[model samples]
Target: MKSTYQTKDFWAGCVYVAIGLAAILIAQDYKMGTAARMGAGYFPRVLSGLLMLIGLASILRAFLQPGERVERIQLRPMLLIVGSTLIFAASVRYLGTVIAVPLMGLLAASASRMFRITVPALVGLALLTAFCTIVFQMGLGVPLPILGSLFGG
Candidate 1:
């Protein structure tokens, strides 16, 4: 008998399983009321159960279907993107959106091959910063400060 494999689907299924299990575990402490009187945990538990089922189906399909294998992961872009996100999360409170947004954009830009401190890049950064401000700050009413206490804004 020959063995069939689909690395992408298998890995995606594994990730879904992990996320579902984690959500289920975290929601265990909360009370799960009946379907009619839904508790805090009810929705999460139901969603997680669905996710688990989808993951199971995906895993089964990986073995049954003929699909491509997972491509090699790129470390540089991954690290830069992840690191920039961490920086944004950690510094958002201290640096505020006005400063943190541009910094995050620059870090993300550095991950790409066309990274340059050119006029176009600066314009793009400005546009991104404005969009973030309008969407997250003005539209969503997120309480993040535009300027931190250091700048006194």
Candidate 2:
């Protein structure tokens, strides 16, 4: 019925604080130019500060307010998300964006129970993919690895 936040969340918050603080300090070692372009360190420093604030908030909320007991722990959805991400990362180099993109899409879609991948869905996916390839590759001339030509290139 009642529970504090997960111990993992507390530790994760602490870790974020440490990382943000470390990043801010480390960026000072880099060469940042004057105010016009913003020094190399400026953006990172700002981001780290933001992260630090979030981490502090996370820590405070965990301590003060707490969270409800997870009455239902749905492992399948979590597994699907994590597994698909791993598959996407591992497959990207071998398959390239053309194939990998669809696989990633399918896997992400598969993550939800109600979303069954149908023939129409597959067709739509392929068509949209072709549109993307044309827009980004042919029209815009941005470089993305197509499925073929890897044997030669």
Candidate 3:
């Protein structure tokens, strides 16, 4: 008999199970401690177990309910998103948050079809830069420079 379930859910469930089992294995060496006095591994182990359960439920739900078929993944957006993250990580140390934050915003915006190099994108960049600066630098008092040594700061 043909299965009514989507293959995607089954595979996703398998992945979750694998990850949970791996976490359990890795945490085995660490001291679990009591429920009151949790050890370092306890949280990860518990979270992984939960993830596995959720994945299993998703798989089961797929069989019982109708769902939209899996769509093809878009590579351009994925690449741009990953590239933006890498750019931010690489530049933040040298260029500092003031420069890197806006740059990341621009790059991330470029990943979407809705955004373009226009007034709105520029305004978004400005807003994001201000928000990040206020939150991470002023409010949180992170040690990152407003302008790095590269900029003669």
Candidate 4:
């Protein structure tokens, strides 16, 4: 006997396929270019095509697997990810990189299994923040506002 059809996963796959197709169309309009030189839309167009392929595979998985457990999308993890993003967005502009990075780390850490994060993890997160800041601000020469010059800028 066939297992229960996963309606949510099926619909999500359909939506992904539709979105991928739309992206391809839009990227085409933006003039994705030749083999030697890529236009603004080239990578997006290629990525979207791959996405469409993956969506089809997912749709097949949802139906063809015998006695497959219905995949339940957990709300908690979703909420955690979404909440962290929101917090980062809200704080980034006002707080700036110096303060924002640590705050972002703290808020993001709350999303994990442990409400209180270990010092090592916190340190790791801080390093990630510093790496991102340096790469964007110094290496790429993009201006990221640092709230206070804690590291002497």
Clashing residue pairs in all predictions, respectively, total: 0, 0, 0, 0
Model 2 CA deviation exceeding 4 Å by range: 5-16, 20-97, 148-153
Q: What's the candidate order when arranged by decreasing TM-score?
A: 3, 1, 2, 4
The digit string of per-residue lDDT tens for model 4 on 1-153 reads 234354655666787899999999888777678868988888998899999998887777667653345578787877767777787677666667767777766766676786777788878887987887789877897666766344444
* Best by the lDDT measure: 1
Name the better of 2 and 4 by lDDT.
2
Task: Report the C-alpha lDDT of model 3 over 51-103, residue by residue, as the tens digit.
Answer: 88988887786677635555678999998899999998887878988898888
lDDT tens string, model 2, 1-153? 134555445656788899999998999887667668887787898899999988888777777766543356688888887888888678665676688678877877777878977899999879867876788878897665666345332
Clashing pairs in 4: none
Tens-digit lDDT track for model 1 on 1-153? 033353778778888999999999999999999989999999999999999999988888788784668888999999999999999999887888888999998998899998879998899889988988899899999898888766776
Q: Rate the local accuracy (lDDT) of all candidates.
A: 0.87, 0.75, 0.81, 0.74
Reference-based TM-score of each model: 0.61, 0.54, 0.62, 0.49
| Candidate achieving the largest TM-score | 3
Query: Candidate 4, which ten residues in sequence have the lowest lDDT sum?
Result: 1-10
Q: Whose TM-score is higher: candidate 1's or candidate 4's?
A: 1
For model 4, what is the error of residue 144's alpha carbon versus the real structure, in angstroms, after optimal superposition? Answer: 2.4
Ranking by lDDT: 1, 3, 2, 4
